[model samples]
Target: MAQVLEFKLPDLGEGLTEAEIVRWLVQVGDVVTVDQPVVEVETAKAMVEVPCPYGGVVTARYGEEGSELPVGAPLLTVAVGEPSAEPEGSGNVLVGYGTQAPAARRRRVRSAPAGTAAGTGPADRTAAPRNGHAVQPAAAPATAHARVTAPAAARPQATAPAPAEGPVPVISPLVRKLARDNGLDLRQLAGSGPDGLILRADVEGALLTGTAPARTAEETVVRTPVAPAAGDGTRIPLKGVRGAVADKLSRSRREIPDATCWVDADATELMRARAAMNAAGGPKISVLAMLARICTAALARFPELNSYVDTEAREVVRLDHVHLGFAAQTERGLVVPVVRDAHARDTESLTAEFARLTESARGGTLTPGELTGGTFTLNNYGVFGVDGSTPIINHPEAAMLGVGRIVPRPWVHEGELAVRQVVQLSLTFDHRVCDGGTAGGFLRYVADCVEQPAVLLRTM
Candidate 1:
């Protein structure tokens, strides 16, 4: 006897309501252990691998890659306990959502003959479980078909064809696959399950009646969407990381009355200081770390910019401690990973933290917590070879510092025209939090430190 356990998507935490399926690690008929990573998903905050709670043979997967599923939606099913081969020990189990124990079980039937790929086959008439109900698999055909689909666990009720227009009334993924493989439009069938839900019997009935797509039709027409030809223009859905970024920036633009102030400063001293420190035979300090240190010092003098405006409370909340967020653009999208207690850390620590976070961001392994809770943000757009940008405030945060590329430029040094490494710095702050005077002082101090690295030593 085998009990088919239905596994639904779990709450990924941090108020995430849904996730887009990125890839499936296992397929139908694959044996898995408890807590094995079954699927990889991309949520608004980060990429996560979801683990299965039950160890058994994978029977079916609900959603396809690139499909979005809400939390608690059916992800897959596994035949636990009764499946022949079992692993020696359970691997690392993730404490995800809870699942119901098997209520009952029955042996699978193998009487029916296996069918073809383009036609109906032996359906795993397992009464699919839902909403914490124990699965009660029905007696299934023993024959292994070229393509077999899982049947929804439903009570004994007269099944009928569902409407063709609007959403399809199918519950069993196995039935969906069967109709899909045979090219039977489910819209043409009336469902018999509760609430007109299409069941496996409905699909099998259609196949037996020759309503399935003919051999020539199956060969010519497929259910999958074809790629757009060149010049056809492609439409990528705004979802996942890209969608999250779009929403956050749009909200920042809509709610924050932001203003930008920028200035070009001689960064020759800062560059020389970095070279000196690295030449001292220690971990090389990056320019971003140097600027981060400068920002922290500047924030101490003008803490007003290191705060966010609470609209509901109608107050400007100034944070005493700084959780610094630095922007890093990766293959997925732009992500700001926060370094906790950044204000308390030195230049060397900031450099190490920035490197770690940047690596995590590039690999798409940042957690939701690491991606949020920042008092201020540092945008080093200079890495992209851009000199300047009036950066949008990362919503809920009061200000952001933008750094441009440092390039050699002729400038007046001590009343003498000379070539100096120069860089542009911009500050975008919420007008509600601070006025131009405070913002100006902060930027001026930062520029002063860049012109003379010794000024940062006093802040130390």
Candidate 2:
């Protein structure tokens, strides 16, 4: 018997719990090999290609293009295990915990017999092909839990410690498939197995006692979320990159007691220094890199702003290393790609790293590893032709420095009024980390470095 296996959305780590399907690469009925890219998804401002592990015929796909899917929602199902062959899988498509080959056991599959009506509702989930013959959602099963998958052999292994908590703590693919086919959300059922593990008996019991509600088989097997049609004048979905950005900013606003400080400085010296550095002919340095270097120097002096507040432990976590994040606006969306260690890098290194990250951001190829664990953020809204902005802190970071356009405006240079390269700098910091004095001190030091690039030498 050909066994059909479901592939759910894997966790696109670093706190990203959902992704929007951007495109579909395979169709139902298409025979696929192990580790083939099956779909394109955008999560946390990055586009990632999801690969299927099993080499088999695609049986069904879930979700439509532009639809959102949670971490553990079903992505697709594949029919493997041909009459005589044992199908192979790599299980390395996801980052961690490579899933192994499916159990080779001959546990009976309970599909309906010929001429008998297939029991309707979730129990009979079918695969719909793409290409208009039938529709397969680019955005499949958006949103759900991220659970660890344990093989059948491992499933029966007795537990020694207390039951681990979080997400769906269930075993038995047979039971899970049963629930999915019957339109039962595994999360809703109470597991009577060890440590709240959901067992086959519990699910069957729920169905028999009318405890779990199931949809009819005629209902769509996969979730096909409807997006607004062109010119339909509907509210734009706050999903994918947009949704992730909104959530981070909203959380920063809600939890952070923030304050903003701004000052206009004669960036004439900073620009001149950059020009000189380029004239000397190495890989040219960017003004943003200069500013980032200054920020790192300033952060070293005033480390208070480089730390975030721990609400649970009620402690202020001060980080020794600097993982600097810079805001890059690309066609995909605004993504903040982080430099591993900003404090240690020179301007040349910063410039190169910034260029690399910007290119990746534009291509939507940045990984979660490149986008998270930031100590502070640098927002260069200057390219947008703006003067300044009170930037929202990229939580759970303590601060963000906003840079405005560098224009030749009339400024007091030395003691005379002159048309010089001047730029506005704004710092938005969490109030819990430090007072206005410390924040003001950090900003003033940054301004000093911008006015006279040599001022950075003091801290360097």
TM-score of each: 0.73, 0.71
Q: How many angstroms is residue 416 displaced in model 1 relative to the true structure, after the best TM-score fit?
A: 0.3
lDDT of 2: 0.74
lDDT per residue as tens, model 1, 1-460: 7655666677777677768889999987899987788999999888888878778888768766866666766688787775333212233333233233321222253444544223222122344345434233344433333222322332233444455457796765766886776567887776654456675656766666666544454344553334222223444555678878998999999999999999999999999999999999889898899899999999999999999998999999999999999998988888899999998998899999999999999988788889889999999999999999999999999999999999999999999999999999999999999899989899999999999989877867
Best by TM-score: 1
Against the correct fold, how does model 2 do in TM-score? Answer: 0.71
The CA lDDT at 277 in model 2 is: 89
Model 1: residues >4 Å from true position, as ranges? 82-136, 139-232
**lDDT value, residue 204 of candidate 2:** 60
Q: Which ten residues in a row have the lowest lDDT in candidate 1?
A: 116-125
Instruction: Report how far off residue 324 is in candidate 1 (Å).
Output: 1.0
